[model samples]
Target chain A: MINEKDTRLSKAFITVSFIALFLGATAGLLQTLVRGGVIELPAGIGYYQLLTAHGVLLALIFTTYFIMGFLYAGISKTLGTLYEVPLKTGWLGFWMMTFGTGLATVFILLNKATVLYTFYAPLQASPWFYIALVHVIVGSWMCAFSMWRQYYIWKQITKKKLSPLFSFMAVMTMAMWFIATLGVAAAVIFQFIPWSFGWVEKIDILISRTLFWYFGHPLVYFWLLPAYMCWYVVIPKIIGGKIFSDALARLSFVLFLLFSIPVGFHHQLLEPGISHSWKFFQVVLTFMVIIPSLMTAFSMFAVFETTGRRKGAKGLLGWLKVLPWSDVRFFAPMVGMLIFIPAGAGGIINASHQLNQVVHNTLWVTGHFHLTVASSVTLTFFGISYWLIPYLSGRTLTKKMHKLGIIQTVMWAVGMFLMSGAMHLVGLFGAPRRTAYTTYSDHPQAAEWIPYQAVMAVGGTILFLAILLVLYIAYYLAFRAPKGETEFPIGEVEAAAVQTPIILENWKLWVGISAMLILIAYTLPFWHMIEHAPPGSQGYKFW
Target chain B: MPQLETNKPKKLKKAEKEQDLKGTLLSVMLLGLFIILSWGAVYALYLSR
Candidate 1:
C-alpha cells in the first residue's frame, strides 16, 4: 500500500478529475444536440462557448489531473515515499492547478473566453482567460519539477543507475511535458496575454500558431504515455503475468520522447507561409512515431501469448481464450487497445502530407481524436480508476462495481463507434468541422451531412449516459464501497527478461537528442516565418 | 545422417516450445495490413478530389 499522506494527494487530484469529467461531458452532450439540430441552445448560451468548455475541461483539465494523480501513486509505491520538498511542491502545484481550473471555468461560463480550446490568436479572449492558462501550465511545471526531484532523491539513496520502470516512465512523461510546455508557455506569456489585454497593438498569427503546435502535438503524447505506462506495467500484473521485457518498455518510451516532439508541422500542413520542404521533413518525423507504437503493440501481444502458453494453452490462437476476459480490469483496457487499431490508422491518414487535405478542418479530425483520446486513453483511465480509486480510498472493488464498469466500457466503445465512425465517413465527404449547425441555405451537399450529424448526437447521448455511470462508480469506490484493501497492481519483470541498460537512464543523453531533433525540425522554418512575416492582425471578438 | 536429422528436429521443436511468438507475429502483421488499407483508401480519396 502507498503511504497515507501520498494517497491524500492522489485522491485530491483524482477527485478534481472526476468533477471536470462531469462538467465537460455535460457540455459535450449540449454541443452534440445543437450540432445535430435536435435542439437549439438557449438565447444566452453560444455553441462555440460550449465547445470551448468541453475541450478545455476534458482534454486539458481532466486528463492532466488524472495523469498527475496516477503518476504520484505509482511513484510513491515504486520509488518509496516522495521526499519532503517534492511532496510540498506537489501540494502547491495541485492547489494552483485547481484554482486555475476554477478561474478558467468561470470565464468560459461568462462567455469571455469562447475562443475554443486552441485559443488561436486574433480570436481573442479576456486577459484573465490567458492568465488562467498560465496558472495551469506553470502549475503542471511544478508537478513535473517535483517528480524529478523525487527521482533524483531516490537515485541518491539507492545508488542504482536504472530507476524503477514506473518511476522512470513517469519522469520521462514529465520531462517531455516540461519541454513541450515551454512553447505554449512562451506563446501565452509573451503573445496572448499582452495582445488580449491591449498592451500590444496586434498579434503575429503564424508565430503564435507555430508555437502552439510545437506544444500541441506532444500534448497528445502527454495524455497517451500514462496510458502506455498502464499497459506496460499494470495490465501484466492484473493478468497474472510479468512484464514481457523491461528494456523493451523503456526503449519504446525513449522513442516517444525523442520522436513525438519534433513533428508538429504535421498539424500545420494545410496552413500556408511554411515551406513545403520543411513540412515534408516534419511529416517524415511524424511517421517515425509509428516505430514505438508498433513496438508497443508487439510487446503487448507477446506478453499475452507468453502468459497464456505458460498456463497450458496450446495452438496458434489458443492464448487469446486464456486471458482474463471477464475481469473488468483487463476488459476495459482491452477494448481501448482494440479501438486504437482504427484510431491509429486514422492518425496515419491525418499525418500524410497530401492526404491531410482530404479531411483537414473537417469533422473527421474531431472524430479521429475522439477515438484516440476519448476512447483509447479515457477508457484506459477508467480501467485504472476501477482499482486505483478503491485502493486510494481504502475500499474494495466489489463484484457489483466491476460489472457496472464493464457495462460502462461497452457503452463508451459503442458510442465512439457510432459517432467517430460517422465523423470519419462524413469527413471524407467534405463536411466541415468546428462549425455550428448549418445547411448553407439548404444546399444539397450540406443536406447530405445531416444524417451523419444525427448519428453523432445519438452517440454523444449514449456517451453522456456512460459518463454518468463512470461518476457513480467513482463515487461508490471512493466513498460507498465496502471498506477493505485494494491492491495497487504493479507487475514484476519477467524472470527471463534481460537486464535493463543503465544508459537508458542517462537523462543528459536522451534530453540532448530530443533537443537537437526539435531544433533541426523547427529552426529554419521558424526563422522564415519571422523573417518575412505579414503585418500583425488586431484581435477579434466574433462570438 | 540419421543422427543429425533427429537432433536438428528435436532442437527446433524444443526452442519453439520454450518461446513461441508466432501468434504475436501474426497479430501485428494483421494490424499492419489494416493500417495500409485505411491509408490507401484515404489516399485514393485525395487523388479523386
Candidate 2:
C-alpha cells in the first residue's frame, strides 16, 4: 500500500546495511582470536588482510551504503518530493556494490589485498581488489549523484529551503567520501595494483596512507550521519516533540562535511615525516570536532527531555522512567545515548596530543570505536529499521520480538563497554592495535594481557549473538509481519510547525573557499615530495 | 504577549535557523582542519626535534 519511492529507497539501503553489518560482525567473531598470542596464522592469511577487512567492513561499506539510504528518506520528507531516480538507480547501485564487495572479499580470501583496508603502499595486494574497489567507488558515486540529482530536482519543484537534517549530512558525507576515495583510488589504480601487476615502477606509501584515511576517519561518520540524521529528525518527531532546531542539525551536517575530512591527520599522530604545524592544527580540530558531536548530544537530549517532561517525569533523572522503552522507536535513542558516553568521552581523550602517546595503537583504540560505532551508528540503523519495516510492509512487530530486540541491544551496548574497558587498561600498558596476538613468545609485555584479551573475545561472542538477535528482529519485521493495513506517517509533526526556506549564499565563493582550504592543507606536503628531497632517498612514481 | 497558542512549541525562526547553520558550519569545519593538521604537525615536529 505504500507507494512512496523515497521510502522504498530508504528501506533498500537498510537491507543492504544489514547485510554489510553481518559481514563486519562475522569478521569480528572470526578474529576474536586476533589478539591471541598462541594462534598462528595460516600460510595464506596475512595480518594486514585481517586489518583491512575489519577497517573496510566497519568504516567504509556499512556506513556509506547505510547513509545513502537515509539520505533518500531525508530528501523526500524535507522537500516533499516523490522523485524516482533514487529508486531505479538505487537497486542498480546496490547490485554493483554487492558485486564489488564480493570481489573485494574474494581478494581478501585469496590473500590478494593485504595493504590493510586503506591499502597503504610498499605493502601490496592483488589487482582484483583494486578492480572491485573501483566498482564500489563508481557505484557509490552513482548513488551520490542520485542523492544530488534528487535534491536538485526537489529544489526546482518545491523552491522551499530544505532543512539540513538528513539531506545536508548525506550530501556532505558523500562529497567528502568522493574526495577521500580519490586518494586511495589513485593509489590503487595508478600505483599499488599496477606495481603488483608489473605495470608501475614503484608506489608512494606515505601519500597513499595520508589520503586514504582523510576519508577513512570521516567515512565512519558517513555511516554515522544517516543514523545521526535519523536520530535528530525522526526521534524528535516520533517522541512527541519537534526537532529542537532543524537549522542546528543542518549546520552540524555541513560542519561535518567541511571539517571532518581534514582531521584525518589525527590517525597519523605516531607516524614520521608530517610537520608539527599539521599535527598541532589537527589536534585543535579534533577538539573542535567534538563540539558538533556534543551539540548533537545536547539537541537530542533536549528533544528527549521534552518528551520526558511531557510524560510528567519530575526531578533530576525523573525522565529516565518516562521513555516508552518497549516502543522500538523510543527504545533505540534512549539506549543508544547511554552507549555513546564511553565512546565519545574516550574519543576526546584519544584525540588529545598528550593522550595520543598514552594510548596510541593500543586496545583502547579498539574499544573506543567499537562502542562509538556499534552503539551510535548501529543502534541508529536499528531504530530506523524498526520505523521502516512496519511502515513499508504494513505489519506491526510483535511485542515479544520488539522487547527481545531491545534487550539484545542493551546487552550488546553494556557488554561491549565491559569487554572494551579491560582492553583499554591493557592498551594503556602498550598492547598494540592490529596485531596477530599479544602473546608472541618474544615479547614479555604481551603476557600480562593474554587473559584480558581472552575476556574481550568472550565479549565479542556475546555481542555476536546480540547482533544476530537484532538482525532476526529486522528480518521478521521486513518479511514475517502478518498481512494487514498499517500506516505510520513520515514527516508528520504532532502539531503544525512553520516551514523555513533556504537562503542561497554566494555558491562560487563558498566553493572557492573550500577549494582554498584543501589546496593550502595539502600543497606543502605534496610539494615536499620533490622540493625538500631527503638525501639518498629514491624517487618513486605512481604513474 | 502575542503568543500563538498550539500544542506544539513555536516553530524555529528563519534567522535563528541560519545562525545555527553558520555556527555549526564554522565549528565543524574548523575542527576538521585542526584534526587533519594534527598528524602533519606531529611528524614535522618530531623531525625538527
Who wins the lDDT comparison? 1
Chain B TM-score, structure 2: 0.44
DockQ of each candidate's interface versus the true one?
0.77, 0.06
lDDT per residue (tens digit) for residues A297-330 in model 1: 9999988998899898899899999999878999
Best by TM-score: 1
Output DockQ, candidate 1.
0.77
| lDDT (Cα atoms) of all candidates against the true structure | 0.94, 0.67
Error of 2 at A518 (Å): 2.4
lDDT of 2: 0.67
Off by over 4 Å in 1: B1-14, B17-19
Candidate 1: deviation at residue A480, Å?
Answer: 0.6
